[model samples]
Target: MKLFRSKQANSLTELVKACQKQDHQAQVQLYERYKGRLMGICLRYARTEAEAEDIFQEGILKIFDRIGDLKKPESVDSWVKTVMIRYAIDYYNQVTKGQKQLISTDYIETEWESDDYQNLFSKLHTEVLLETINELPEGYRMVINLYFVDGYSHAEIAQLLGISEGTSRSQLLRGRNLLIKKLDLKGVKQHEKF
Candidate 1:
């Protein structure tokens, strides 16, 4: 396993070097290797399949354009993911610019008991959870995706979305509450205290 891992990393390094030299075949190979994972990132950030495609394409172009700037070839996957996320945010901002706000100032508070929904969430399918998340209001969805799925800090989300850390926290809280309600409507039972 260690040998295979080293070989994989070495191959990736070679690929990055070739891509930096503008080798078309290496670029295609790199794209093919990363496209699926990057597409998943794009899909999470985009409301529609078409929009996701647009984001993915833009992200790929950015990656190609900036491949020479990559300092650590071993971290290429993470760098690619970061690029896709930035492109997704940019695309979202462009699409929603000058639009009515989707985030509500009115906050909902719920007392979450320990291990209250663990079993319920454990029993649910990933697809179901993803669908429920996608149904969230745009701001809620973005916050949830950035915070929960992508493991971005609230401070990072605030910077990404041009909001305060308090707003990011509020949005995350509200998004979770909305998710719980949706899960309840789907017949996932919670503890009586919930």
Candidate 2:
């Protein structure tokens, strides 16, 4: 039986083969192809560019080391994404293990007044939003970054932070309210509208 290979699949298979064989040049090419998307993922999970770069390096290294374990060549991008997320969560879990504190329910229950953000994300550049998020206190920043920027659900953030989903949701809501206050106080207006 003649096996048919689509052009993209053939290329991916070749890349995977090279990766499995420890071809440095092929690995570089693969990294170049996905670095931006991967770095964006890293940025969402990380607090700083340096930290994101560190995670990016670690994630790619893991990908290269485990290339042999990837059963399907076409799923490499998704695989990388999953690895990045897991690595991010691992980093967070390690950093926050003993620092997990129960914030007051009164603070968590503070009625947030940022429903406008729900409709305003597309209006603001993600970079601006990220900058605003970076301005948050460490705990609030991490929770919000994972929840809003990384697209992790509350349950996932709760699990990652060793907090309840209620805490995760409250943190996110409070973070959003705080962000809106910061933006408003800074007189920053959205350049575009969602």
Candidate 3:
């Protein structure tokens, strides 16, 4: 039982130790605990649920393969997040095939400070939102997801998508307009209380 308890200094020591010893049950426990959050993270970058699931699985495999290289156990969450983000960027690169230019994110600020962000998301089913996003044209969908879903700035999105900052901004504007039209929310002011 003590072996199952991670060292106090190392947040991920228990999971890491279990994985190292090929403890399937421990691995399953870890997966169950983190699956939802990681999926949410992956969903922002993936164009579809199928793709997001694939990314999630790949990210877990990456964790398994690279956990041994982690010098600090407590940093497990951050480490996993880094791997996931990198995987998404790589996937985007592979899928887009050099269509986007990497842009910067120094000036993009989000206005979603109200609790409404959570409430709005709760009211809007994930599947519906995803379907709507999937319906967007390739470039618009990617920019919108990266900016709003993944919390990347226009600059970061431009860089990630290999487009100019202006292009990223334009795509985001276009994506939002398309979404409003699709969802029938045209003429509504930005930040209007739902």
lDDT of 3 at 130: 68
- In model 2, the clashing pairs are none
**Compared to the true structure, candidate 3 yields what TM-score?**
0.62
Off by over 4 Å in 3: 1-13, 16-26, 69-72, 96-123, 185-194
- List per-prediction Cα lDDT, in the order shown: 0.81, 0.71, 0.67
Query: Quick one: best TM-score, which candidate?
Result: 1
List model 3 lDDT by residue over 1-194, tens digit each.
12123345353677767766778887787677667777776876677788888888888888778767877666666666667777766776787545653332322333445763445444555566766676676677778877776567887877776789998888787677666455433113222544
How much is the lDDT of residue 177 in candidate 3? 62
Worst 10 residues of 2 by lDDT: 102-111
**Which digits, one per residue and each the tens of the lDDT, describe model 1 over residues 1-194?**
12113248888999999999999999999998888778888878887788889899988999999999999887787788888899899888789645765665435687777786775676666666767777778888899999988889999999998989999998899988888777655535323334
Worst 10 residues of 3 by lDDT: 182-191
**Which stretches of candidate 1 lie above 4 Å from their native place?**
1-7, 103-107, 187-194
lDDT tens string, model 2, 47-92?
7888888888888788788888988887776777777778876876
lDDT score for residue 111 of model 1: 76
